[model samples]
Target chain A: MKSFLKLTYMELKLQLREPVALFFTLAFPVMVMVLFGFIFGNEAEELLGGYGQVDLSVPGYIGMVVGTIGMLSIPTTLANYRELGILRRLRATPLGSSPVLWSQVAAQVLMTAAGIILLFIAGLAIFDLRIPNGNLAIVPAILLSAFSFFAVGFVLAGVMPSARTAQAVGMAIFYPMLFLSGAAMPRYIMPDFVQQIAGLLPLTHVVILIEDLWLKGTWNLTSVAVVAVVLILGLVISRFTFRWE
Target chain B: MTQVIEVRNLHKAYDGVTAVDDVSFNVDEGEIFGIIGPNGAGKTTTIESVIGLRKPDGGSVSVLGLDPQTEARKLGNRIGTQLQEAALPERMKVWEALDLYASFYEKTVPWEPLVEQWGLAEKRNTQFGGLSGGQKQRLFISLALLNDPQIVFLDELTTGLDPQARRATWDLIRAIREQGKTVVLITHFMDEVEALADRVAVIDHGRVIALDTPDNLIASLNGETQVLFSVPNGFEAERLEKVSGVTAVHQHNQHITISGNGPLLANVAAALAQHNIAPADLRVQQANLEDVFLALTGRTIRN
Candidate 1:
């Protein structure tokens, strides 16, 4: 436990020290949210089945927050470590590799949460976007959605031959998911085939889960069920495939 | 002598390509043991097995009396390793790397002193990517020594350094030996092995062709003494080879060269003098590790 803490702290320190990771994970989503708040204005636009634009944007950007941290930051760090032999080098030490991995997970959780918080603060201050009524369900939806995204990243890091390849593959998957799902725009506007393809993406499920919790007052177990499957799939698959060298 | 590491008939292959074949050796405490070889000669594979990085296909390895594969967790804090082509995160600072490495061991040397000892004190705050090649190497050496390890493995630690930087790093390696730490150095560089290794094992094509002190290996090259000078007018090269202990003599351009075992230079000198021919540039070149490799494999180390 002591070693874990030390490693987590160092991992956070190392990651946060880099400007590129900080911008993509935290600042970029917040920047996009600020832009969305201005474009939507004080008037509520009917989108996503009569939900206000602000109502949809908040949940959608929250999906971006989790996706960016997961698909961008997590894979870059892990695959880079593997390419650099950092994982193998650490395995030779008493600390082993669990701390390095858990640290990444912890750092991702912390940073993703921070990005979400920034979105809320920006949302409340700029657009007066209030938290929806089903706040209790929002917590589980966000956590499960975030875990599934991180799991995708872990698997990418494990399977890619090098950090450069991981970054390339991760970004290729991330940008499309961001645009096709509800993260960049309302999924309701995408063509039927595009929407169906989005349905295959975890981000689409995350956005749906969070929006169901935020816009509708009802708890959506179906969305919860899908997100849980994704969560298990991500964690189990990544764990089995993770390689040190 | 305390045998800190022992390997018996270690063998390994990758995709049916043999990397290490029937290799065995022992490392004593406080000795600088070198594994010298050409590329793909299984030097790194052999060391990796000893350090528990790879499982041998056959035979066994024991380090500090514990099996490397099964007992790696126990050995982790005790052995330091600088693996070939391994690296730290690019943005990691020198001091942070040192501190992080130090945190892994239950007992650690003060990282502050190691920074200075490895000439990395000035670059303590510098990111790894910002440092020069030499500085990065020093940082790696510092990290290897951070735990005050009982044994350290350095594989091609100076493969890319300039001659000056290589020499400075060599001194640091000597200092490691002087401090009573067992060192395992793996390299294809002949000079590096000759300069720093107390004893060496020459590996070629996944086998140990020769194992002995550097001096013995070179001496076993049949002296292979090389004497070269401007061939005096009418100085007979064939006559020089006829002298006792002179196996062969050749003439190239304006120089005559003699090569053989035992007192070739002395006899060549006498023959040249008996002919009353004086060559100003006469000098005997000492046989090097490259010759030992050539004599064993009939090819240069670089090939």
Candidate 2:
């Protein structure tokens, strides 16, 4: 346990020391949130007709944060570590193997929290958007979604041998989850067939839970259960396929 | 002497090609043992297997009576290693790497003295990528000895070093032995083997072909002497052969090489004097480890 904590702290410190990684994981997400919030302003409601009656900026910013911090960040970091032989070197030491993965997950969690807070601050200050109705429920819902998406990213990184392939794979999953989860385009506006397919994705359940808590002031038990199952499945797949080299 | 490391019929294969095949050897305590072989002779594989980096397909390997695979963490604390192709992060500072590795061991020598002793004190704040080849090699050696381990393993320790650095590293190996730590050195340089190894095992195709002291291996060559000198005008090969201790003489265009058993150079010089043929540039070369390696493996160590 001591070795694990020491090594994990070392890994985190080394990663945070890199300005490039700091920008990508921490600053980039917040920048995207601000950019998208301005672009979608009050004009977004008129473009999508009545369904866009709800200003899509807040939910959209949250979704982008989840996607970037969870899916894109996890796979790229793991793949880069593998390619650079960092993972191989760590495996040779007495450090516990699981801590390396967990440290990455922990960093993502911290970044996601910072991103969410930044997005909220930007939403209120720049877009004049009010806080969501149920602050208590929305927090847990967003956190659960982050956990699920990060797990999926971990599994993707573990299974893919190369960083380029992992990046491509991460995007392939990320964009669709963002677009179909009512995060980019609302589910009510999409074609019925597309909605049915999106419903099967884990992100769809997360978006549903977050939207319920934020806009409706109520938690969706069914959506939360679905997200929980998907999180477990992702964790299992990652554990079985993780390769140090 | 107790054997600190023992391997029995160790076998390892990668992609259907065997890297280490039925190899076995024991390294005794407090002795500097070297594994000398050409490239692709399975020297690294044998060392990695003993260090628990690679698992043998079918054999037993024990370090200090502990199974490396099962007890790697415990055994790792007691052994220090400098891998041939291992490297730390480029952006990591020298002191950071030292501290990080020192954290893995249960006990470690202070990094300050080690930095000064390894000549890395001036580069303490420099990143690993900024170091020269010699400096990097020295840092690797320092990291290996940080734990003050009972056994130290060095793989191809001086592969790219210049002659001066190589000699300095050889002295360090001797110092390690003097400290009563068993050293297992792997290198293809016969000079390094001859200079520092108390005993050496030459591995060819994953099997031990010769194992003995440097002098013993050279002396077992049956007194083969090489005599080379420029043949003077009117020197006859038959006269050189007729000299006592001269087994054969080969003449190659102004140069003569005489091979024989006892006092071959003296006999050749005497015969040349008798024939009034004083050869210029006379030289007698005694057999060394390189000659023994060629005799046994039919190939030079470096080539």
Best model per TM-score = 1
Error of 1 at A218 (Å): 4.4
Q: lDDT of candidate 1 vs native?
A: 0.85
- Please give, for residues B1-303, the per-residue lDDT of candidate 1 as tens digits: 999999899999999989999999999999999999999999999998988888899989999998988888788778888888788888888888887778777888899998888888889999999999889888888888888888999999888899999999999999998988999999999999999898999999889999999999998866577888896566567877678877787887678878877777788788878988787798898889998999899999998
Candidate 2 lDDT over residue span A79-106, tens digit each: 7677766676566555546766777777
Candidate 1 Cα deviation (angstroms), residue B175: 0.4
Best by DockQ: 1
For candidate 2, list the clashing residue pairs, or say none: none
Cand. 2: chain B TM-score: 0.85
Scanning candidate 2 chain A in windows of ten residues, the lowest lDDT window is A46-55
Write the residue-wise lDDT of candidate 2 on B192-266 in tens digits: 999989899999898888889988998898857878889755656766777888777888878888888888888
* Candidate 1 wrongly placed segments (more than 4 Å): A44-52, A133-137, A190-197, A216-218, B229-282
